[model samples]
Target chain A: MREEADVVVIGGGVTGCGIAYNLAKKGLTDVIVLERQVPCVGASGRCGGGIRQQFTTDANITLAMESVRLFEQLSVELDTDIEYEQGGYLIIAYEDEVDQFKRNVRLQNSLGLESRFITPEEAREIVPLLNIDPIAGATFCQTDGHANPFRVVHGYARKAQKMGVEISKFTAVTGIVVEDGQIRAVKTDKGTIKTNTVVNAAGAYSRDIASMVGVSLPNKPYRHEILVTEPVEHVLDPMVISFKTGVYFSQQKHGPIIGGIGDPEEPSSYNISASLRFMKRMARTVVELVPAFGHLNVLRQWAGLYDVTPDAQPVLGWTEGVDQFCQANGYSGHGFMIAPKVTELIAELIVDGKPSMPIDDLNLKRFEGEITGEAYVVG
Target chain B: MTEIVCRCEDITEEDILDAIDQGYTTLEEIKRVLRCGMGPCQGRTCIPLITRIVARKTGKSLAEVSRPTTRPPLQPLPLSVFAGEEE
Candidate 1:
């Protein structure tokens, strides 16, 4: 491992790798990415891979819209087949959520996202097997979809390495050497890398990394479970999600139906063990939504953590007391969906001293006062 | 003659080596990149074969290569089973 670098990014997941790739693309090649395990070994590899732009918050909607544009060209830009499918995302609404969804659709349409609130019958037209009896209304965004999270991480890491960025796997960050409120070096199990700038893109462990610099972050990790069924005929295209039950599912390009459900009772922790209760709840919810899924065999079940903040939004930009210590974690559960644009903006912030987009609304300082939480977060 | 390692994903020995050459040296890394152990069988048939290949190529002992994590339902089961419906 190199003893020195211009910048040292703390994780090698999609967020970290994406940031590294973007940094290198912008002429910052003397960078190193440290991963506790192999790339995509965290939430980046375990997510349901659904990318959507139908968020209730303007920050999330604008970020996802720009990310969708980047994802449309990511496969060609990274020189890898990321299996990106832009079939669209359908968010079903229950009786109580109808008004909220109407306002969300209006806000989304105002932001130039071609999202429209449709009837239950229209939703069934999009998803033929959907049980729309409980759906009061639905919103559809044709530009939102899913992709292979593993391939996305692989493409970013490979391209970043080819561009002369070093990626060190199995290297755990132990501490951060800070003097006079400026980052001087990063201590790891292998050796310390002398660097002036550090980006905390550590995903679920971002809070822990922040603590190393004596900066307290409010982000906490929450476990979410997902399952995939055996590869079958491609019946479903767009990802169908329900705001009422927090159950979502989509068919991969190769045919497996992958989905997940959120357990409201889940406590905040780093625990990612798959549970029988989650499996049962997910099975019941999915079958209740689409009875045809009961016939498919579940191949595997796994879990990943969502680095959640109080507002369910990501904390970006530089830290308050620590100079040159960039904060880029806390995506809640939608990191992969917005990674392309988020990483690009973060790179611009680090290299050009400013980002084109106005991200002051997403900084850690927002937590000091009253914040409006995002309402469209799904499992 | 080419040797097929993962029948579920139709992955050949050459495919595994290519993924390893691309810096995906571990069992889990190769599985994500190539889908060797992620098919219907869930690595039942291919895990052992791929482990040996990875050990030989990376000069690591069989015990040195970390085993693939075994997740639930051991075998494929209908969603109805978990949903509390009779098969």
Candidate 2:
């Protein structure tokens, strides 16, 4: 299936649709998205769906604030119902880390985010059933929220197509054609697509996709597991997080309690099976956090891979000596939430001949161990 | 009754023991030969049952039974829903 297009985007996850949406909206209409399997078969649909602006880095914090604003108005902006609930974010602190929470809240407030340290009593006021004794302090942000991930990708893909972008699902890219140090075309299972400009948004598999062009991406897959409870009434209004335990949960509109925890030994893979240890550990944390969830049965649990870079920040710039090759891959775990601005940045980098933001600091070259500092508050 | 364990693939504890007795060592190999948990719903409903069966049959810990493969449509919808108009 040999074809020609103005741009060929690889990987149909959130970032892929994001880049396509922005490019189509920016007037580069001849775009084709080649997906390996169905869309959202990757990390996009499998994420925690928590959108927050709390970050240790200035760039991520600014991008997240901008992203939260977009998510707040995304339904009207995209002309589709995204079910974006502006529930607040609660980060619980225990042990000696209570001081850390206070310092983070102070820094966050100084950065213009509506975050502050509160007493354990205030924490329980937000979530009545939460265990407040062992908890020393908490950071509350009123702007952070959660959304349905499937709707986000579907929304962008729909809007991208409405703006004239072609997304071909089940199209696995096997090779990238480069000639004279420039990307010429992309070879996929369906056929070869002749295009000078190509964007790599392959999520966890970004390293493999970039390797086809002889570029070694530092991105690697890490397993993140999540679980859901049987439908319960709307009791929890805010998205709760425990910095001590890697647990976060939100009561969805459908009434099911959805959330996940970070695993220390989560190996890299596309594997999505839930583990017994994770269930037991997650159950323990869930019961400790919200005692009311103890009686509710776990309907299902699942796992997905996160594309983790060395610094955990996304690599979002063109490679040296590789012309016409733009990359927006390796968000580590924050890809889904920041995708809108990331896509717009990548599209502007392509069409406007430069990025609308100061994205030069995000190139792959910054992760050579020289820039070790990055955001720490990830759930 | 030992019970019919995996309803999605109609696998039972007796069938699992039979596969292990036939020298099927790994879970993947046993699943390949017996079709233990393969179906439209994938392994969501059948996995815990298979894990329990394998742990009971092999006299191993529950954690040693190994995790099953999870495919896409984490919730399976019709391909048609993804088809038709791009918008």
Candidate 3:
């Protein structure tokens, strides 16, 4: 815990670690990451780990596609096997959504992605046991996949540490010292670190950190629960996502079928408690999709927060009033998948004062008026 | 039969001690290393005992040794709850 640093990042989730790792690797000096809890102990660790580019919104598709490209080489670069499975993402559309699904697939194709629309039977060909009777069609993106959230977080943390970046865990940031409208220091539970730059990569806690500096982020934390079944013989290959049921699942290489469902009734709060409702709904939906997974014993069920914004997109770039305060929050549920690219671009923005990636459309001001194009969120 | 500290994860007192000996002093670290309270029950059954073990081993007061971060669903709920009857 130093008394001063060049930059103080306020979170230990994959976002913070990834930012720290990229900053340090990019030759930034005196960078320190302050984590209130252990690394990967937040939403970054609790997610379904699905990385996909099959999104209705261009912002999400671009971010996710770039993330997938980075993930393809992350294991070797970080020297840690992230257990990345590029098996593909299979999105099953119910009869009612076939038209909209085709439009999304067309958009994805125009964006240079290799994704395509396929018949439900074609989806069955990919997953073998999919219940295609009720599904009208599906979209397959071979580049989309899943990775180990734990390993990715740790890998970034370890690499950041190796690059002389100090990551102080169990140290909570209590306040932000903004003197004359510029970041002066970061006050933490452990100690205060004087710095000019502060990155709020706080995930669900981003709002709290932003409030410390009087910046209002429109992101709220919503609870999302997930469960893992006892490892069975590998049955599913691509991740099976359904828009109708709001459920998505994938069998990991080591065997457990891991997944979750989104509850529209879930309120915005800090609650991470698992709910019986989510488990049952997810189970029933899973069974309804693939009857063979009906009786698979659930090994564990847990909940995590999703930092959702008004348009279900992320709020990136520097704040309006704050000179050196940058935000990388409001990722909704896709933070882990887009972390590598997000953090890389953030580092570029912080270090070079401008990001090469086009992120002006993702600024915090988008929610000030009528937002456009609601992001297509699925299971 | 020997006593069990964490039933859901099948973690015993000895496993906790061995984890501490291996230098995983904190509850979260030990939990990660030994899967002590990371089962379906999510540490409700074993956290107190592990907290005591960690305190005793580290010679710190209960308050001095931090409890593992309590993540949500505080209790495991059935999948049926989220799956409504309309289905």
Candidate 4:
């Protein structure tokens, strides 16, 4: 790799590529992105690919709303097919979460989103295959959808490379050299790159990068597994999500039903091994939600790590001691959905010194105090 | 050339035994050496079958024979996604 110049972005997933693309657009050429493996080798490639604006918090909803707008024009802007489909996201709620679902819908409505609370029967109308017996209430947003994760990251990486951003795959960063509270260079297995700015976008390994700079980040990595069923005739239209079960499923454009479930008790580690426990739990929940899923054969299963913060919000902007180091990590499980907007803000922060959008609440300092509301709609 | 176990990669029971003869013991190692379960299905079809073969060959239980470490890009993707256009 070249000796490097302006900015060094770690992690070649969607977020890192998104940052590189935005930074290159800002005329910051000589950008280097380092990925330990191929792009989308982590959670970005393994996620459910569900882009939803139906969030309980304004921060998440706003981020998703802006990202959806970008995704609408991405295929043309990036000159590649992202396979984006706006089949919408249907969030069904049990009796316990009905109040929270109603409040979330009202909050989403106040922000000019067309999200609304619908009866269980209306949910069935949207997805006829759904078993609505257990669903007490539901929320629907037509703007939410899923895209091909591989295509999305590849588009960003390809578009950024065309703009003079160098993405080095299989380049593992061993350490970050910081001197007197300023970043000096990033040490990698390939070679050392002298840089004044470092964007620690290393998804699950963000904490490890932070510790190298003598800073501590509260983000932990948890294994989240997903499986796909054999492709069949189009049956499900929208991504069906349940907060209580932490399970979500959606039909891809190619026909496979892809989805995953979260185990809260799963310890923080980099173990990506898929478990039979998850398979059994997912089958039980999915079949209960849509009885037709019981007949479909499961084709494959895999796991990815979620870089989660305590409050489930991302820690953006500059850290305290590291002057030249900026962070755009800790997106929890929804990083793929909000990547475009978050990376745009990170680009603004790196080049123009401030983001056009306000993300003051999303910082590491917020974790020092008693952290209140979390992004409860995690799947 | 016996019954096909891994439909994704078209690997059969005889192929699996040959893989064992070649010293590919673990599920992950066998996948790398023989391509037994490394296909579009990512071993979902052949893991159980291969587990049985490895267990019976090595005289170990299925639980003792650990599965291979699942790497990223769990599914096969086109190389064009990475190969930059000729300028």
Candidate 5:
């Protein structure tokens, strides 16, 4: 069926679904979201779902705080069990990063985040099995947590649909129809969708989606792989991050040790095959961080592409020379966490033409010279 | 007399071997042409069994056989699920 809408939201991941839901909730009904393949089939479901407010930049912190607040009330808000736990985020400061961690704690506190410096004894209390040796000081934040990404994304999409927002899954957005320096419509494999407003919320494929409209978004897709062990009895509570090893992990409520380390030199390609290099690095880092995880057998491993922008900051808002177009991509690897807030901001911008929060710092032009540097060195 | 590899689609060892002989190096290529493990459960229910068959037959190491392309819908939920069909 040929279709048209007030806004044509691209990609059915969490970010896209968030925009759709918020828009509909804010009284815009004629919105249709197009998903190439299926909802949460991209980076949303494949991510580690680590939510944190301890960030270095103002924009990142703002988005993360907003997202954490939304997530805290999301179970009742969405009428779906997202399994969000506010069990705090712990970053183990080992070796030389102790100084960096202290600086980060100061900045986070100045920004009114409830993060602090803790002794190794306090760190051991949170995670008993964690090897505290080679540790300087541990940075702790009570607000950071995790949720089920699939459930959250799907829940948002479901709510959007029930509210009269049309979501077409397995429908690929083939191209964008731009004319007179304005977005005319979006073309799909099935048919064409005529709309003035377009949101490029297409996760890892956001770069490709932007290119469809003749915009050069400086985002490259990088492969990041993660593995999970068989569910064990609850052995840990807080999620652990090592500034030294670039590894982050947490044992879920279902009790499978789930996490992945940042591979510094992951190439810009979609090669998601399980690699020996990834496995060895992940295994070594996880084992070193938590010695108790040594005995657990990894049930499976998988990979997904991170929509990495230069400087690892998210590129949000309207594209250059584009009318009625918005971008909520280039989140590096942190898309899953702040997706709700980011998408909500996009929705607000679409409906009210500006949000209550200041999204100016997150503008796409920041990559050129609008330097607002973020601090949270998370993967 | 090789055993069946793709437990989901029931494409056997001999079928995969013949496909390999025809130059299908990637599991995705074999899946596309032979429809081996591209069933309802995706390769989740079939991959381990297929990997054993591939490793034993080709004499490739387990690590080599373990490295298969991981596509989306990692858990094999229906497309209708994403469509919010409520079935």
Candidate 6:
């Protein structure tokens, strides 16, 4: 490993690799990505890979829309098949969430998204397997879908490597050296590297990395669990989600049904151990939503951490006191969906000193006062 | 003649070696990239075979090559069984 570098990215997930690739594409090739384990070993590899624009926040919807566009052409640009499928996302609403669904669909439409409100009967028409007895209504966005997260990270990492970005696997960052409120170097388990800029793209460990430079971030890690069933003939097209039950499920391109549910009672911790509780709860919820799923055999189950914030939004831009220490984490649970656009904007911010898109509202300083939390975050 | 290590995913010994050559040395990393051990068997038969190949290729002992993580329901079971429904 070289003893010096221009910029050192702290994580090797899609966000870190994507940022590295975009930066190198913009002629900043002297970058090094440090991964604790292999690439996509974190939340990126563990997520359900559901990409949707049906969000309650403007920043999320805007970022998701652009990310979808980028994902459409990502396979061609990266010279790899990311398995991007725009099969659409269906968010079923219960009686209590019908009004919120209306408002969300209207806002999404006004923002140029093709999202619209559909009745429960229409939802069943789209997904005949859906048990719509408990559904009051739903919102559907045809442009939203799922992709292979592993292939995406692999594509970005491979392209970044081809563009002369060094990716160091099995390397863990120990500390960040800040001198007079400016980044000076990064100390890893392998050795220390002298650098002027650092991107804290560490997913669940972003808060830990920020604290190395004495910057306090309010991000906490919450354990989220997911499971997949044995592959069968393709049946489910759209990803089915419900805000009330906190359950989301979609059929993968390979034929298996993958999904998860959020436990409101889950505490903040790094514990990623899969639980019997989650499996039971997920089984009950999914079977009730779609009875056909009850006959499908569950193949495997796993868990990953969601680096959560108080407002359920990512902390982008630079930190208040730490100069050259860019914040690119705190994505809660939707990091994989918004990584393409978020990393592109972050790269623009680093190279051009300003992003083409407006991200002033997503800075780290917004947590001081009252903030409106995002309402559409699923498990 | 080509030798298939992971029959579930139809992956061969050459494919596993190629993935290892591309810097994916770990079992989990190779599994994610090649989908060798991710099939219905869940790495039951292929894990041992791939372990030996990885060990021989990377010059590590079989013990040194970490095993793939084993998850629940050792066999594939329907969701109705877990949901407490009469199937």
Candidate with top lDDT is: 1
Task: Kindly list the per-residue Cα lDDT of model 3 for residues A240-340, writing each as its tens digit.
Answer: 88867779999876677899998888888899877767777888888778887765767677888999888888899889999889999999888999899
Model 1 is docked with a DockQ of 0.79
Q: On a 0 to 100 scale, what is the lDDT of residue A130 in model 5?
A: 80
Q: For residue A115, what is the lDDT in candidate 2?
A: 86
Give one digit per residue, the lDDT tens place, for model 4 in A150-230. 778878887899999998877999998888888889999999999999999999999998998789999999999987766
Candidate 1 lDDT over residue span A237-335, tens digit each: 799998678899999999999999998999999898989999899999898889999999999999999999999899999889999999899999999
Task: Point to the candidate with the largest DockQ.
Answer: 1
User: Interface root mean square deviation for model 5, in Å?
Assistant: 16.1
Provide the lowest-lDDT 10-residue window in model 3 chain A: A370-379
Residue ranges of candidate 5 with Cα displaced over 4 Å: A370-372, B1-87
Give the Å error, residue A110, model 1.
Answer: 0.6
Per residue, candidate 5 scores C-alpha lDDT tens digits across B11-53 of 7778877866744444544654454544545567667766766
Docking class of 6: medium
lDDT of each: 0.93, 0.78, 0.85, 0.83, 0.77, 0.92
What local lDDT score does residue A142 receive in model 6, on the 0 to 100 scale? 86
Task: Give the chain B TM-score for each candidate.
Answer: 0.93, 0.79, 0.83, 0.73, 0.64, 0.92
Off by over 4 Å in 4: B1-87
**Clash pairs detected, candidate 5:** A56-A375, A56-A376, A57-A374, A57-A375
Instruction: Put down candidate 3 lDDT per residue, B1-87, tens digits, no spaces.
Output: 557999866788888888787556788767755667666667778999889988999899999988876654455444444443554
**Between prediction 3 and prediction 6, which has the larger TM-score?**
6
- TM-score against native, each model: 0.99, 0.81, 0.88, 0.83, 0.82, 0.98
Off by over 4 Å in 3: B1-25, B30-87
